[model samples]
Target chain A: MTDALQTDPRLLVLAQGDNIAVLKATIKAGEDILIAGNEVHVGSTLGLGHKLAVVAIQGGDDVVKYGFPIGFAVADIPLGAHVHVHNLASRYTTVEIME
Target chain B: MPEMMAWPRQDGRKGIRNVVLVAYLVECAHHVCKQIARPFDESDVQVIGFSGCFPSEYGQDMMTALCTHPNVGAVQLVSLGCENFKKSQLAESVRASGRPVNVVTIQEAGGTAAAVEAGRAWVAQTRAELQNLPMVAMQPSELVIGTICGGSDATSGITGNPAAGVAFDRLVSEGATCIFEETGELIGCEHVMAERAATDALRPAIVDTVAKAARYYADMGYGSFSNGNATGGLSTIEEKSLGAYAKSGQSQICGILRPAQRPATGGLYLLDVVPDGPPKHGFPNINDNAEIIELISCGAHAVIFVTGRGSVVGSAISPVLKVCANPETFTHMSGDMDVNAGRILDGGGQLHDVGTEIYEKLVALGAGARTASEALGHVEFVLTYKSQSPSNPACYPN
Candidate 1:
């Protein structure tokens, strides 16, 4: 890998102890980046501000961000996987996504 | 010390802008009021009103607060004569504030044409009289600022909202009264906020207010989470709340303010935008402008609006500084934005850098520099029916 590509940081961890990190910019599938001491390959294209798991989250586990649990995972979510409405559900209010 | 030359009001408040407010009593008189104010620039003559034909104690209080707002130099009330809003009583309240007040009823004035003519004549004269309003030296401690995050995306928490929080912290430390609202959006951060309360009694008040919002939204079968919020990558209400909560900064929240109620001292406060009872109103706020109007009614001289999805709405009586959170959205809607907090996320600046920029811009705004929305004539205003009782004294221990 080139020096510029290796040095660029793509994910932003808002606070310590946050299990998920936000994407600083859009990234295409197959891009490998180091997160939490692990180099994880991107499984799919993710847009800016979208969340990615810094650590593997099991089914029914809480998705933590800003050092607080934002929601619980509906299913098992692997590290570097996208965390969104599909696998996450609100702890307070239901996110009724229209099909 | 941050200070500016501001318009001094009889109520002992300072206003960043001296405005001639043309207020319509009901939806029936809206067109006439609009036509009356159409001839003048929005900066000089701005139209604001309540649309409900039925009487609402909440609506009445909001109108009274808005019409007597320090920013309003004079007011002209347009009434349809049949609506339940007591126009004469409103006129009396406006007069009591030591401002010139006029009322024109469409039924008594012979209809739309005559009413519009009378309203325009009054507004024209009021505009002339507003030119001689005294400008006094005002400090940051004398200012009341409000903040709201609309069209939020994930960028809001990390970039825009946190930057705004920095600005709020600075303003609060300077002894300026700073308010942050939209309790419906703060569904899951109640405990976090409670910990930041100034007094022990305020903890329950803060916790109870968020619970009220959670229950209200549950009954309505909706949280404040919109499709745009999800599309922008916010998955749930709790997730959005965590992000929105960052806008409050780390200051000790001194009090909780209900709509149309002013804070007695300069400090950090939380505004409960949701109604007191169950979901009587469709939503806590119909849109961002409603919350902005609520903040203005409580005496915000200017509002700091943090947006990730890029909201362009401004207020009639107060200035709205749009802090765009997403770098991509800022690139697309630069004309509508003031501060580019997105730069922090883009690796161009630190969070404190953007926060300081917002703080400086607000101080400049107080010195008569118009916000991007204000300069673009985005005078969007809204007020609807909602019920709220007086706040508990415990919430304001100071």
Candidate 2:
């Protein structure tokens, strides 16, 4: 099992082989991060429960949740960038963002 | 696989109980039906009715479905002489399903007193024969279960809903029929849900149903997603919908059913609670109990209800298993809850552990064990008039 309590202060992977890890606490840019056994610099700050991709994702790439595709990335999301409604759009029904 | 028990009916369907049903055809016949059902004094012989005077194809269809439901072994129809609800047709449908059925009219029998006496005798005889029916092995695949969440708070989305989602995933994998409803609660997440459809054809229906719900609630001068929702810390309807959608687990969306429409196959099916067009008879469902009635009409054997603020209500025909998600609410209202998914939030248990507990409880209930609601004799049921066009041809095979 992946360590539930990892050395990283911000995020933890819930399941092994998962492409994304959940932020355990708010993370800031330029922080040292360990994801999928690799050390990388945080690209951006992210809130708790928000997702951070272990690898870089390009525009129109599918975002998986619960190991299934929930939506697609609307723009290129760097590794450790906060992944949520802002960067992702549902592939099924139109979601109009309120300005 | 472990062997499961069931009440085998003559019609080839199996049930956990062999119930004798007393049905009221209209509002006027309700009292007589209740009085007649009283003599049986057993949960297996329960009274269920529709209180409408006008003719409704929907009402007729639901009545037939309930009267011949797998759990029902026989039926008695109560009618007032002047109502448009056709007592003969209703009784005929039940009889044709291979169940014994009879009808008694207050006007013909002289009054309520006489009709009640006649109805009581008929019920007694039917109950005797129904008790003798053979028990058979019921597989998990034959079970039809429904789920709904009410009295929701922030904790609902985080714990209880996802826990139920875990149970839904297990049940669907076993080939059990699972249904989750309330499109109004699912306003913002429709696009995400539509993507899970089993086919490309069902995608539009998914969008249309959510659109229909949005328009219906908008016309009422309120968002189907409520302000109380915001107070509960749910920022938008879409966010609330993401939580509500969690109840379906990670299964493929099999099909869509309107109120009382049974699914063609077992899996995760969505029940569209919104009316087809404009609101006709007030709100789609007055409250949670009304939603429960729709679940029963769709042939659910039981319901798994998730709540955060606390809900003490339970349904009549089917058993209700209450799951409490908030640690504080669970502490305050422990008596009302059957499972404490909130334990996970308290760091006392894991989500998978609580989910496994719920799944085992469902299996026991499906094997003739009575839930707290069923033991309390809370067999609350109701049917109201609403219109629906037949399902689209592309949605089902002919």
| Clash totals in order | 0, 3
Interface RMSD of each: 1.2, 5.8
How many collisions between residues are there in candidate 2? 3
lDDT of each: 0.87, 0.76
Model 2 Cα lDDT, one tens digit per residue, B92-143:
8787888899889899999999999999998888888877777888887888
Which regions of candidate 1 are displaced past 4 Å?
A: A1-8, A16-19, A36-38, A53-64, A71-99, B1-3, B224-236
Best candidate, TM-score: 1
Residue-level lDDT tens digits of model 2 in A55-96:
688899866544445568789987766666677775655544
Q: What is the lDDT of residue B211 in candidate 2?
A: 88
Instruction: Assess the local accuracy of residue A65 in candidate 1 as a C-alpha lDDT between 0 and 100.
Output: 82
Off by over 4 Å in 2: A1-3, A6-99
The CAPRI classification for model 1 reads as medium
Please give, for residues B251-275, the per-residue lDDT of candidate 1 as tens digits: 9999999999989998999998877
User: Residue B109's C-alpha lDDT in candidate 1?
Assistant: 100
